[model samples]
Target chain A: MRALSKKWVALLGVLPALALVAFACGGEGEEGETFKIGVMESLTGPGETYGTVAVQAKQMAVDEINAGGGINGRMLELIIEDSKCNAQDAITAYNKLTDVDDVKIILGTSCSGAMLGAAPLAEEEGVILFSGLATNPDIANAGDYIFRTSLSDALLGVDTGNVLWADGIRNLVTITEATDYAEGVRRTTVEQFQKRGGQVVGEERYPSDTTDFRTQLTKLFNENPDALHVAAQAEFAGGTIIKQARELGYDGPIYGEVVAIGTTALEVAGEAATGTKAIITDLDPANAKGQEVLTNFRNRYDYVTLPWYLGSAYDNVYIAAECLKQTDDDQDADGFRDCLYGITWSGAIGDDYSFDQDGEVVGLANVVVEVLPLAERTQDNQGYRVLGSAPAE
Target chain B: MELPIIGDIIRLSRDPKDSLRLSRSNLEFWVNLLIISWAVAFAIWQGVGFAITVGTVFAIWAILSVSLNLVVGFTGLLSVAHIGFFGIGAYAMAILTSDAAYEQLRTEAIPTLGWPFFAALPVSVGVAGLVAVVVGIAFNRFRDDIYVLVSFGFAVIAFNVFLNWRSLTRGAFGIHEIERPAIGGWVFDGELEFLALVLVSLAVVILIAWFLMTSSFGRVLTAIREDEQATEVFGYQVTHYKLAIWVISAMMAGLAGGLFGSWTTFVDPNSFVLMESILLVSIVILGGLATIWGSLLGAMAFVLLEEGMRFLPFLPSEFVGQGRQVVLGILLVVLMLFRPQGLVGRYKL
Candidate 1:
C-alpha cells in the first residue's frame, strides 16, 4: 500500500510539470491572421445571465464584422475568458490574455467589481479595457486605458433622485444589496436626494447572496416613508424584494435601477412587479439600427435578458472593429484609444454617443420606466413601458 | 521491498537508524530542488509578464497550501477559516497602502495610512494571528466535526464583515491601484521583481513550516493527531499546541494574502468568499495532507490545471468555463478512487 501511494505521488508530481511544458510549447498562435482582442466576461457565477448575453452579442458582431471582410482584411477573433464576476478571476483572466494570448485590447467584464478588479492591471500594462456592462461611477477615473459603453451609475443616480423628487417623494426608505455596483447606485442617488432636501427615513442592507429580506423590509415599512428604493445586485433579489414587499402589504410607490426592472426580475416578481419604476439607459424603440440589432439578437439567441447591455455589447464590437480599421494594427493600443477619443458614431445604444476625456459615455441619458402588468410583458420591451426621460436634477 | 522515496519519507520522522532511508530522502530533496530549478528556468524562458503573473500566483497558493497543511495535515485540525485570515491580511494591506484608489470614488473618507508594503505586512500578519488565537481559544474545546462547523462560521462572518464594512473595506466596489513594494530608492514595480519578492516570502513561510515540523513540538502534534486523548494523558497541553500551530498557520496565510493584494493591486470581498476557503482546503487535500512538498506540488497542479484548460484550442469557447470545473471534479473523483490518502498524504481525513 505504501509503495503504491508513493507511485501515485510520483505520478502526480511529474504530471503537472509535464503539462506545463506542453502548455508552454502550445502557447504560440499564428500572428496577423486575426485581430485577437480579449473578452474578459463573467460567463459564469452570479452575473451569468447578462454576461452570457454580452458574450453572444459580441460574438454576433464579431461574426458580422468577419463576414463583412474582417477588420481591414484580417479576421477579428475574440479570446473570451470568464471573470466569474469577481476580482481574483478577473485578474487571472487579464493575465492570461495579456501574457499568454498577448492581446492588447480587451472588451468586457460584465460586473463592475470584475471591471474594477482587472482595471488597475490593464491601466498599468497599457492595455485597453472596454466594457459594455460595468457601470460603477468610480470606473470613470480607473485610468486612460479603461473605457466603457455603459452609462455611469452616477448619472443613473442623478436621474433616479430627480425622478423621486419630481414624483413628490419627500421621505424615502431604501433596501440595498451589499455590492459595489448596488452601493454605488444607492449612495449616489441618496446624495442627490439629500442635496434636494429629501429626507431618508430608513435604510437597510443585505448581502449579495442572501434571499431573506423580510426583516429588512419590515424595518423599512415601519418607517412609513413616502417611497422605497430597492437597490439589488441580482435580478432575482430584486424580484423577490418586490414580491415580498407586496406580500408585506406595503402598497407605497417602489423604485429601482435597471437591473431591478429587467425582464427576469419582473418574471420573478410576477404581478408584484407592476407599477415599479426604474431609472435606466434604454434604447430608443423607434431607432432603425437599434430595432435591427434587437431583431437580429432575438432571431439569433431567441432570448434577451438585458436588452440594453446586448445593444451596448454589440456596439462595443463594432466600435472596436472600427478602431482596428483606423489603427491598422491589432497591437497599437495608443492609436486605438486616440481613435475612440476622436470618433463619434450612431449605434443601437444611442445616436452619436462619444467618449469624454475620462472615457465615460456622453450624449446618453437615463429614463424612467414602469413595469407593466404580468400578462402584458413582451420579449421586445421586457415588460416595461417607458415614461419618458427622467426629470433632470 | 519498500519504494525508495515513499519509504524514506514515511520513515523520516521515525527509525533514525536507517542510513539508507536518509540517503533516499536526500535524493528526494534533490529531486525537489530539480523541480524548483525547472520551474525557475521555465519562468525565465517565458518572458517577464507570464513569469511574474503565474509565478506570483503560484507563490501565493503554495504559501497558503503549505501553511494550511501545518494546521490540517500536521496538527489534525480542519480549518475553513484560513481564507478569513487571508482577507484580513489583504484588507490590511489595502487600507494601509493607498487611499486614492477608492477615496476618489467614495463619498465618505476611508482612512488610509499610505504606509510602505513591508512596514504594513507585519501588522497584517499579526492581525490575522491575533484573530486566530482568539478564535482558537474559544473553539479549541470542540474537536472533530464541530470544530469544522465553528471554523466555517468564522469564514462566513469574516466574509460578511468584508462585504458590509463599508468604512473599512470599501464594501464590494474594491480598492484598486494598490502600490507595489518599494525600498527607499527603488520601487518593485516590475513584474519580475514582485514575483521574486513573493517567492522569497513563500520560501520563508516554507522554512518556518519545516522548522516546526522537524522539532519536538512537531512530534507532539503528530501524537495528538494520532490520538488526542493519549497525547493529553501523556501530560501534553493539546489546546496550547493546537492554538500555537493555528496562529502560525493563519499568519502565514495572512502574509500570502498581503502579497496577493500587492500583486493584483486590487482587493475585494468577493475574492474571499466561502467558495475560496473550500478551494484552499481542496488544494491541501489534493497535494497530500501531511507533506509540505505536497502543498507546493498541489498548488502548481491546481493552478496549472485551471490555466491549462484554456490552452486546449479545441474546447468550444462557450462551454470552456464549465468544462474546466467539470474536468477538475473528474480529476478529484479519480484521485479519491485511486489514492484515498491523497497523492502523498500520510493520514486520511
Candidate 2:
C-alpha cells in the first residue's frame, strides 16, 4: 500500500510536464485578444544595418495599421526576434516566439541558411513562416508551410546574363566569393551567361573576407574583358572589386547583383562604381510613391532603408495582420498558410503583392540601375538618389 | 515504459548465454531495428530524398558516436580528432564517388584514385584507421592530459586541411553533389528508405560494437583502463590494446563519413569540424560513459532534448543558436562537478 502510494505521488509529479505540453498546444486567439505577428530579422551581423532600418519600416507599417483601427478592431501587435543570420540561432528565436508566445504568423528571416532550418521546423509545428529576403528557389516549394518575398538566385542569374549578352559584352571576367550563396550565384551566372553566348575570359573565386583583390584584379587587367561580372551580395567584396579594378587600371564596365545596396562600394570605389551596372527590383530615386516611403522609413527608423527586399520584411507583418483580420476562424495553420496566397495590398514597394502558385510575387520585375556620380546624386530626407528609372524606359 | 512488441528468436539460439541477458518474449535493440528497417523501407518506397537524407545523417552519427565511445569511455583515451577522421573518410568517399574535379588537397587529403563508392568506403576508413594507428603509437608515450591536447591538435590540423586546401575542398565552398548508390537502376533517390538503411546500419554497427566490447580483447581494455600499470603487470600489452581500439574507432568514423556523404549528398570541412567531435564526446558524457547501452541511450536523449528544446521559447535567448552548446556546456560542467560518472554511469564490458 505504501509503495503504491509513492508510485501515485511520482505519477502526479509527472502531471506538470504533461501540463506543459498542454499549455504549449493551447493559446489560439480568443474572441477579444489581438492577433500577434512575429518579425524575425537579423538584429546583428553583416545585415544588422539593413535590419535596423527594417525594424523601423515594420514599426511604421504596424503603427499605421493600428492607427487605422487595425484589422477587425483588434490591434495588431508586432513581436520581433533577432535571428542574427545563423540557422541554429534563428531556430532558437523562432521557437521562443512560436512555442511559448504562440504567434501563428512569423515574418522572417534574412539569411537563406537560417530560413532553411527554421522553415522546416515552422512547417512541422504548423507555424506559417514567411521570409523577407530568402532568395533560394529551392526554399519556395521546400514545404507547404514555407513562403518568401524575394526572387530566386536562378532568376537573377538568368536576368543578369541575358542583359549582358544583349549589350554585346562577349568578353567577361567573373569573380565570385567563397560562400554557398555567393557560390550559388557564381554557378548559376556562369551557366546562364554561357548559355547567352558571353565568353567568360578569366574566372577566379576570392575569399569572403578578402580586402585586397590586387592579384585577381591584376589577372583581370591583363585579360581586359568587355565586362567584369562580380558575383557577391556582400559589400566588402563589392567595395574591393571597385577599389581594385580602379587601382589596377582596368577600365571595363562592371555589373553585379544586390552588392550595390552597400554605400561603401561608392565610398571606396569613388567614381568607379558610379557607372557600375546593378540589378534591383525597386527604385526610389525619382518615383513619387517610392521617394515618400524611403523618407518615412528613414525618419521612423533613423536610417535610410531603400532596398526593395528590405521593404518586403516590413510588409510581411502588414500582410499577415491583414490576412488574420479577413479570417473569422483562428484554429487554422493550413488556412492561414493558404490565406497568405490571397494578398493584394499596395504596401512598401508601391505594388500590390499577388502571390503566385509557389507563393512568390508575380510580375516581380528586376530593374537595371546605373550608379551615378556622387556629385550628381541628390541627398534628400531619405538618403542619396541611387538609381534613375531604367533610363526613362 | 513501453515493452518490446517483437521477439528475437535468432539471438536466443545463436547465443544462448546472451539470450539470458534479455527478457524472454521481449525484443532487444536488434529486433526493434529490424522492424524499423521495414518501416524505413516503406518510407523510401514512398519517397527517396527525405528518407535518404535522414538515413544518411542517422547512420553516420550512430557509427561516429559509438566508435568514439571505444576511446573516450572504455579506453579512457580522450581525443578530439575523431572529427578529423570523419573528414578524411568523407573526402575519400567524395573523391571516389564523383569524377575528380579531383584536385590536390592538404596533408590528410587522398586522391581516392577514382574508386567506386563501395571500394572508397573501406579504403577511406582504412586510411583513417592507419592514421589513428600511427598517431596512437606516437601519442601512447604521453600519459593522461597530454594525450588529449595532442588529439586536439590533430583535429585542428585536420580542420586547417579542409579549410585551406583550395583545389580539392574548394576551400569553404565544400564538396557538393557526391552521387548516391544506384542499385538496380534506381539511384537511392534519397528518401526515408535511405534514412532507415542508415538507422539499420547504426543498429547493426551497435550490435557488432557490442560484440567487440564484450570480446576478450575488450576485457583487456577494461583492465588497462582500470589500471594500465597493473594491466602491464598482468602480462597485457596496454599500448597494443590502445592502438587496436583507436584503429577500430577511426574505421567507424570513416564508415560514418560514408553515411554522411550519402545523406547530405554533400561533404565539406564544416561537417567534420572539431565541434562535431566535441558533440560526440558530449553524447557519451550526457548518456553515460563506458556503457554500450548508454551510448545508444545518449544519442536518443541528445536528439530528443535538442528537438524538444526547440518547442520552448520561454528559455533564455542566450540559449538560442548557441543555446544547445551552452546547455551542453553547463550540463557537462555540472556532470563533472557532481555525477562525474555520467547519466547511466560507467558499465562493465
Candidate 3:
C-alpha cells in the first residue's frame, strides 16, 4: 500500500508539469477576427529540404499579402506544425491543429504519405487539406476535402514515357524505390510506355532508405536496355543510382521524375549526373515572375539551391488567401472550399491556376530538363537545363 | 467496518505474496477501474471527437503491449517480430473488409465476400496463431540470442513482403476505406462507440492474461524463464511451453491489430515496422515486466508522453519537430538510470 501510494505520488507529480507545458503552449488568436490557417510540413525529417523551403515560400506570400493591408482588412495567421514525414506524426499534428489550435483550413504536406494519412481525418472533420507538393496517384481520390497544387504522378509518368519515346529510346529498364510516390510513377510510366509500343526490358524495386542499389542495378543492366528509368523519392538516392549504374559501365541515358531535378542529384552523382533527364513542374527560370520568386527565395534561404517546390508552395499560399477573400464568413470551411474550387487565378508558375473536378491542378505543364556538367552550369542554373515542355492534360 | 468485497481486497493488497499473485486488490484494482471509468466519462462529456480518437489508439497499443508482455515479460523470449503478426492481422482484416477487394472480384465476375468486422477479426487472430506455429517450429531448435536474431529477421522479411507484394497488399498505396465493425444495420462508426469496443476487448484480454498467469501452466513458464535447464530437469518440456505462449501472444497481438485497422479504417505497411515492435517492447519494459497492470500503465504513459512532449514550452519553432523524440530519449535514459526495474515492474531486466 505504501509503494502504491508512492507511485500515485509520482504520477501526481508528473501531472502538474504536463499541465504547465500545455498551458504555456496554448495560445490561440482572437476568435473570428483573423483567418486562422494550419500548415503541416516535414520540418525536421529526411524531407526537411522541401519542408523548410515550403515554409519560407508560404511566409513570403503571407508577408506580401499582409503588406498589401491584409485579406480585406483581416489578418491571416498561419499555424505551422511539423509532420516529420511519418504518417503517425502527421496524424498527431493534424489532431493538434484541429482540436487545440481550432484552425479550419490546412495547407500542407510535402510528402505523399503524410498527406494521404491525414486526408481521411480532414475529410471527416469537414476541413480543407490542400497539399503543395504531394504527387501520389492514390491522393487523387483520397477524399473530397483533399487537394494538391502539384501535378499527379500519372500525368507526369505519361509525359515521361512520351519524352523517352520521342528521344528514340525504345527499350527501357526501370528501378523504383518501394514507395507510393516512386512506385506510382514507375507503374504508370511502364503502362503508358508499353501502350506507345515501347517495352520495359527489366524492372527492379528497392526499399526506401536503401543506399545500395548495385544488385538491382546489375539485374536491370543485364537486360541491356536503351535507357534506365530511375524513380526515387530522395534526390540523393537518385543521383547515387545513376553514379553506380555509370560505374557498372551502363553509358545509356538515364531518366528520372521531378524528385531527381535538384542539386542533390548533381552534387551526389558529380559528372555522371550530366545528360540525365527528368520531368519537372516549375516555371522556366527565365520567366520574370519565376525569376523574382526564385531570387527572393534564394536570398531568404541561402542553403536551398534548387527551386523544387518553392513556386508551388508560394502559389498555394496566395491561392488560399485568395479563396479566403471571396468567402463572406472566414470561419466557414465549406464556403472556403467552394471558393477554392471556383478559383482560376494566375500565379508565378503558370499563366492560369485552376483545379479540376478531382481537385488536381488543371493545365499544369511538365518541363523536361537535363543535367549539365559543373563547368557548364550557371550560378542560378543549379545544373538543370530545360529541354522542352509537355501539355499536362 | 469494511464491506465483504472491500475487506477481501484490502487484505490482498496488504500481503506482498498475495499482491504478487494475479488476484485483484483494493487499491490497484479500484485505481484501474476508476481510470477506465474516468476515460469513458471524459469521452462522453467531451463529445467523443479527437481526444477519444487518440484514446482509442492508446487502447489498441495497450492491448498490443500486454500481449507482447506474455512473451517478453512472463516467458522472457525477447521476441522482436510481434509486429509481423500485427501486420498480418491488420492486412487480413483490411483485405476481408476492403472495397478494393470487391472491385477486383467484380472484374472476375465473382461474388464479393465482403465479410463483416467481427467475422474478419477471428480469422485474423487465427491466421496470426497459425503463422506463429510455423515460425515456432522453424526456430524451436535455436535458443536465446539466436531466437532474438531469428525473430528480428522475421520482421524484416514480413515488412519486405508487405512492401513488394503489390498484387495483394497494393504496395505503399495501402488498402483504404476499410469498413468499420457493424452488426445488422448498426455500425460502430463513431469515436465513442469504437472506444467502447476497444475497452471491452482490452478488459477481456487483461482478464484472460490474469487467469493464465495465475495458473500452474503460467508458473511453469516463469520457472523456465528463471532457469530453463533446471525446469527441464523437473520434467517440463520447455520448448512446448515457450511455443504455446508464443502462439497465444501472437494471436492476442493479431486481435489488437484487427481492432486497430477497423478503427482507423485504413491499413498500410508503414504502421507495422520494426520501430513499432521496438516501441512495444519498450512499453512492456517501461511499465513493468511480469505484470499485466504494468503493460497498461506503460502504454498509457508512452502515448501521453509522445503527445504531451509536443506542448513543451519555450522550445524554438525549428526544434519543435524533433524535440518530442529528444525529450523521450532523455526521459528513457533517466528512467533506466533511476528505476531499471521499470516504473511499476516487479522484476528487473
Candidate 4:
C-alpha cells in the first residue's frame, strides 16, 4: 500500500510539469533587433523535393545578406514552418508565423494548394505572402498582398498554345494530373489552343496519386492525335507518363511544361524523354551573372535539381530584403508592398522583373527547350538543349 | 476514491450504490468543463494568435473524437469512414454557401447555391447523416476485422469521388473563400470569435453525447457492445441501436467538418484522406475507450503535443518537421507501453 501510494505521488506530479513545460517554451521571442521573415514550405510531404531546395536557396541568400553587414545593420532571421503541402497545415503554419513569430512577411508555400489556402488569411491580415514557386492562376486574385516570383500557369498555357500551333501540331491530345497546377496548365493551354483554331482530339485527367496511366494513355492514343501534351504536377508523374507513353508506341512529338521536362523528370524518363519539347522558365546558361549564382549554389549545396526554382527562391529573399530596406520597418507592410510596386530589381532569376498591379511577375519569359538524346546528355546540362523563347501570346 | 494524476475523475469503485450514483462521472464532467473553460479563457487572455488557432482546432478534433467514441468506444463499431462523412459535410457546406465558380467540363459553369451559414450547415449535417444511414445499413452485417476493412474501402471510395468529381468538388483545385458563420451582420470572422463559435458547438456536441451515453438507449448499446448475440437474445433489436448510434456519431462529425470548412475558408480532397480516419481512431483509442471525457483529454493532448513539438529547442531547423513526426511516434509508442488502454482509456484496442 505504501509503495502504491509512492507510485501515485510520482504519477500525480506529471500534469503541472507538462503545463510548466508548455508555458516555458512559449515565452515571447526577442523581436525588433532583427528582420524576422517567416517561410512556409512543404518540408515533408509530396512537395518536399522542391520545397527543401527552395528553403536551402533562401537560407543561402539570407546568409549572404547577413554577411554583407545585415539588412541595414539588423541581421535577417528566418522562422521556417512546414506546410506539408496541404491547406490545413498551411493555415496552421501561417498562424504560427504571424501570431507567434510576429512576422509581417512570409515567403513560400511551394505547392499552389498551400499557397491558396494561406493566401486568404495573409491577405485579410495585411501580411505580405510572397511565393517563388506557386503558379496557379487563382493566386493572382488571392489578395493584394500575395506575390510570386514564379510564372503563372496562365502564361505558360498561352505559350504552350503558341508553341503547339507554331510547330504545326493542329490536333492535340492531353493527359493531365488532377491538381490545381496541372489542371490550370492543361485547361488554359486547351483554351488558348482552341482560340487559335487548334482542335483538341482527346482529354484525360487522372488523380494526383495515380500511378498507372496506361489506361488513360491508351484511351488518348485511340484518338490518334498529331501531338500529345502531358500536364503533370510532379517529376515522378511526368516521368512515368512519358516513359509509359513511349512504351505504348506513340511516336508523335511530346510536349510538356517545366515540371514534366524538369531535371528529375528527364532522369526518371531516361532515353524516352528525348526530343520532347517543354515551355519553361529557365536561367539563361549564357548569362554570366546567372552562371555565377548557379556556381555558388552548386559549391554550397553540392547538388542541383531545378536550377530556376533555386534562382527564383534566391531572388525572393533579395526581393524581401530590398522591400525591407525601402520600408525601414519590419512592421510596415503597406510601405513594403508599395516598395514592391515601385521597385524593379534584378537578381538570379531574371533581370528587371517586377510585380504587375496584380502582383504577378512581369518581364520573365518561358523558353522552349528539347530533351537531348541519351548519348548527348550531361550532368551539367541536365539532359535538355534550350531552343529559342516561346512566341508571345 | 482518488486515481493518481487523473485524481477522482476515473475511479473504479466496486460499491453498487456508488456506481449507481455516478458521482465520479460528475467529477469527470466538471473537470472537462474546467479544462475547456480554462482553454477558452487562456486563448482570450493571450489574444488572437497561435493560442486561439490551436484552441479552435482542439474543439473541432474534440467534436470528432467524442462522436467517434460513440461508435467505436460505446457501440464497439470500429469505423474508418468517419472522415468521409466529414468530407461530405465540408463539401456540402462549401458547395451550398460559397459563390465560387467551377467551370464544368470545359464549356459551362457549375452552379453554387450561395446560401447563408445557418441554412447551409444543417443541410450539410443532414446530408452526412443520410449518407451514414445508407452506409450503416450496408455495413450492419459485418463485425471486427471485416468491418474495419469494409469501412476503409468506403473511405477510399469517398476520397476518389471527391477527387474525380470535378464539376461538384472542382477535383484537386478545391473549393475556396468559404465564409465564416454569420447571423445577419455579426460575422465570426476574427480568430477569437471563430474559436468561440467552435467551442460553443463542441459544448453542444458534448452535451448530446453525455445525454445519449447516460440514457437507457446508451445502456442497450453498451450491452450490444459486450455481447451482440446476447443483447439480441434479450430482445434489444441490436441492428437498429447500432444504426441509430452510427447516424448520430456521423452527424456530429459532419457538424465538426462544417465548422472546419468555415474556419479555414478552404476544403480540399487532401484534407480528407484515409490516413486521417486512422488518426481519428488513434485519438479515440489513445484517450481511452468508453469515456466521453477521455475524448476531450485526448484531443487536447494530441493538439498541444503536436504544436509543442514546434518549440523543441534541441531539434535542428531543417529536421523540425520530420523530427516532430519521429518524436511523436516514439512518445506514442512509450505511452502505449505504459498504458495500453491509452492516456485515459478504459479498453485495450
**Could you say which candidate leads in DockQ?**
1
**Can you write out model 1's per-residue Cα lDDT over B1-349, one digit (the tens) per residue?**
1123455545654765675455543534434444455566555644567766777788899999999999999888898989999999998888889657445564434776788889989988999999988988997888989989999999999999988887877887777666689999799988778888999998899888888988999989988888999999999999999989999999998898888888777888888989889988988987777898778877876776665555554556666666666776786676667756654565788
Q: Can you write out model 3's per-residue Cα lDDT over A200-261, one digit (the tens) per residue?
A: 99998888788988998999888989999999988888889989999998899999976665
User: Worst lDDT window (10 residues) for model 4 chain B?
Assistant: B1-10
> lDDT of model 2 at residue B235?
89
**Candidate 3 residue pairs in backbone clash:** none
Pairs clashing within candidate 1: none
What DockQ was computed for model 2? 0.10
**Cα lDDT, model 2, residue A297:** 71
Candidate lDDT (C-alpha), each? 0.83, 0.64, 0.78, 0.84
Candidate 3's residue-wise lDDT over B116-139, tens digit each?
A: 999999998999999999998887
The predictions' CA RMSDs to the true structure, in order, are: 4.3, 10.2, 4.8, 4.5
lDDT of 3 at B32: 44
Q: Which regions of candidate 2 are displaced past 4 Å?
A: A1-32, A36-69, A75-106, A113-129, A140-146, A162-168, A206-217, A241-251, A260-275, A286-306, A333-342, A370-393, B1-66, B72-349
* DockQ-based ranking: 1, 4, 3, 2
**Local error of candidate 3 at residue B10 (angstroms):** 7.1
Give the lDDT of residue A140 in candidate 1: 91
Residue ranges of candidate 1 with Cα displaced over 4 Å: A1-29, B1-48, B101-103, B106-108
- The residue ranges of model 4 lying beyond 4 angstroms of the native Cα positions read A1-30, B1-48, B101-109
True contacts kept of 1: 0.50
Residue range A6-33, candidate 1, lDDT tens digits = 6555654654565566565555675768
Q: Per-residue lDDT for A238 in model 4?
A: 96
